[model samples]
Target: MQHLEDRFNKRFGYPWVFLNEEEFDESFKTAVKGQTSAPVSFGLIPRDHWFQPEWIDEERATQGRMEMKAANIIYADNVPYRNMCRFNSGFFFKHPLLQPYRYYWRVEPDIQYFCDVTDDPFDYLRDNKKTYGFTISFYEWEKTIPTLWATVKEFMNLHPEYIAAENAMNYLSDNGGETYNLCHFWSNFEIADMDFWRGEAYTKFFEFLDSKGGFYYERWGDAPVHSIAAALFIPKDELHFFRDIGYRHEPFQHCPRGEDWMRGRCSCNSYDTLDYAPQSCISRYEKMFH
Candidate 1:
């Protein structure tokens, strides 16, 4: 994170805030320059290791469980080395940034932040009623998603009272059950709604996924988890795709194309904005801005 931030600073001056999960505050504090507020070093990464240090034992255990699974896929297997992020996308709702306002921007470690972000992503979320948004979405191997659906099924059965739609299931399960298009919105970079995600249904979904060890064995990542949650839990029209991200994820990438007002990139699907326009929410924002 420090190294990536160092590179980012050469070209960008955006406020860089490091939320601590625990410890490392002194080291984290020393490494960062300019005005910054430190939050819980990114929140507890639920781990399962028994002999682990107790400095923040509970979090580590939880991380071992939830954080490791999703992170294991590309992180340990691919180049970036080391384990996948423990805090992962949990930092978004953790709300160190939104306590005063109502939204937040989330950046992952080691990702490149390019292009001038003149537009406010939070307002974009509000104008569209979008609970979640992402710059990229792509396919993941079928093998890795072994237990995620099973767990979700369990959650559905247990919470029979919760309302879910047939289309939402289509958004999640696809036409068949053998594979997940895995078109999860890349969470490495995001700006999103707080209330939409912190609600009972979304929280229950995470807990349900956690209980079934989806975050562990199947490597169910925040991308897929958030995608499924947003697709199944949140209304369809309210979910959005930010065409301006020009996002790149090594193995896969999405660049902005003819999204009119967006003039942004969207690799989630070749056809995503084909029906809509990049200006999508931007066009409406103009009316509101009017």
Candidate 2:
């Protein structure tokens, strides 16, 4: 919290909303509150929102978990992680604590922030008419989402009117929605408009995905869910890449190159940056605008 505050939030003074399945103890709350003067509100996720819906087949979900565990997928056997994924994908924005906020910047613990944010990203989103912004782009593990693209395609067909005419479809599909190329913006570092997620198109899209029970039966992640929604519902110009923000989450780091690196006080080696790596979809993201 202190690292994030010192690097960015301290200057912006944006309020923080923390959500967990269990109640946050006083010590945890105090430690977080001590780092920033901005209002800090911690809320427990609602029971219904954080648990598997009654419609889900528990036996199927259990077998799926076992299969994924044998395959050594990350957090494969963790039920709480699946709940967390589902919550973030379709329910987080509706929480009472986040109701008043139109924009949110997602920050995770232990993540390094190398840049001093000179401008407010919320202001940028508002002024520039952007609905979603991200610092990283990558292809999802295909094994985890083998049926997700088919599900999304089915939804698109059923509700064609929800998709924007000038959307970023090419970024997601190469053969006209027959399959997914797995390109998705990493949602962990997102700064997005809540209104966009709450809108009719995204609401219906989430409903469609939820009905499939993939969050439990398959390890459907929130990153691909949000990325697919943004690409289909939002215009290309409204989707942004925050190249100036130097951030690292474990194996991948997005560091600015050359002059901006020096100006941002970034310590990451540009050569080690994953933005241009083979696994990254960033080059394709750039090509879309050209």
Candidate 3:
């Protein structure tokens, strides 16, 4: 919270809304409050929104978990992780406290900020008509989402009308829409228009995916879910990449290059950015424009 405040929110004064499955402790709330003068609010996630639905077949979901765990997939055995992915995918934007807002910047804990955020990305989204913005893009672990692409293909077949006339399909697939290339924008950090999620296309998309029970039966992540929807439902140009924000979340980081590093007073190595890494989808995303 402090790092975000010093690097960005301090200048923009954007209020922060923190949500959790359980109530936040007083000490933690006090600590976050002390981080910035910006208004802060905490909300407890509804029980139904943060837990697996009763309709899910526990036997099948358990078998799925066992298989992934045996294959050594990260978080394969963690039910809480599935709940998180599901909540983030379909319910976060629907939280009562968030309904009044039109735009949001999702921030995770322990993220390192290496540069000063000079502009309000919320304004950027609104002014420029961009629906989603992200700092990192990469391929997901194929082992965790074996059925996801097939399911997505099914959804597209059934709801072709929802797809945009000009979309970012090329960024997601190498051979038309036959297969998913597994590339997705990392969702841990994102600046976006919540209305897009709340809109008809995405709401229906999430409902279709949720009905499949993939959140529990398979480790379908929010990153891919959001990326796939944005890539298919909107114009390709509506998705913006925030190259100026130097940010890191654990094993990967995106440090701005050349003049952007000097402009932002960034500390991370410019050459180390994942923009062109073999596993990154940034080059694929860039290709859509040229």
Candidate 4:
């Protein structure tokens, strides 16, 4: 919170809205409030929005967890993590406190902002007519989402009207939506227009994915879920790659290159940027432009 406030929010004065499954403690509220002069709001996620739906079979879900655990996938046995993924994928934009806002920059704890943000990102997104903005892109774990692509293809066949004419399908699949290549814009750092998600195409997409029970059965993450939807339902131009933002979340970091690095007085080493890594999908995302 302080990193964002010091680097960006202090300049734009955008309000911060934090949501959790339970009420935040007084100290937590005080600490966050002390970080910025901008308005701060805390929202408790509704029970239905944050838990495994009753229709999901616990036995089948447990078996799925066991299979993933045997394969040694990270967070394979963690139920809350799956719940959080589902919530972020479908419900975060619907929270009452967030309703008044059209644009949102989603921030997670322990993320580092290495540069000073001089421009208003929300205004930039609004003015440019961008729907979703992201700093990082990468491949997801195939072990976690075995059936997701098939399910998505099924959704596409059932509702062809929702698919955009000039979409980012190539970024998602090499064989024309026959399979997923696993590339996704890492969603932990997102600057986007919530109205896009609230729109009919995404609403139906999320509902279809949720009805499949993949969140509980196979750990379908919000990163890929949001990325796929944005790639399929909107023009590729609507997805903005925030290459200028210097940011880091643990193992992966996006360090602005050349002029942006010097201009922002960014603290991260440009040579260490994740865009250079073999696992990075940034090259594929960039291919859309050329």
**Residue 131, candidate 4: alpha-carbon lDDT:** 94
Q: By descending lDDT, how would the candidates be arranged?
A: 3, 4, 2, 1
lDDT of model 2 at position 108? 85
Across 193-259, the per-residue lDDT of candidate 3 in tens digits comes to: 9999999999999999999999999999999999999999999989999999999998899999888
**Which of the numbered candidates is closest to the native, going by highest lDDT?**
3
Q: Which tens-of-lDDT digit does each residue in 147-178 have in candidate 4? A: 99999999999999999998999999888888
- TM-score each candidate: 0.64, 0.98, 0.99, 0.99
Q: lDDT tens digits, residues 1-290, model 1?
A: 44333323333434544443343456555655423332323323334221122343454345544544565544423211112422342334544444544665676555553333456666678876767676665554445566666666666668755644432444444454344545455667666776756678877766566545444333456766776677666556665666665544454444455552244222244443322343222332222223
TM-score of 1: 0.64
Cα RMSD (angstroms) for every candidate in the order listed: 8.5, 1.0, 0.7, 0.7
Minimum summed lDDT over a 10-residue window in model 3 is located at 1-10
Q: Which stretches of candidate 4 lie over 4 Å from their true place?
A: none
What lDDT does candidate 3 reach at residue 78? Answer: 98
Residue 142 of model 2 has an lDDT of: 82
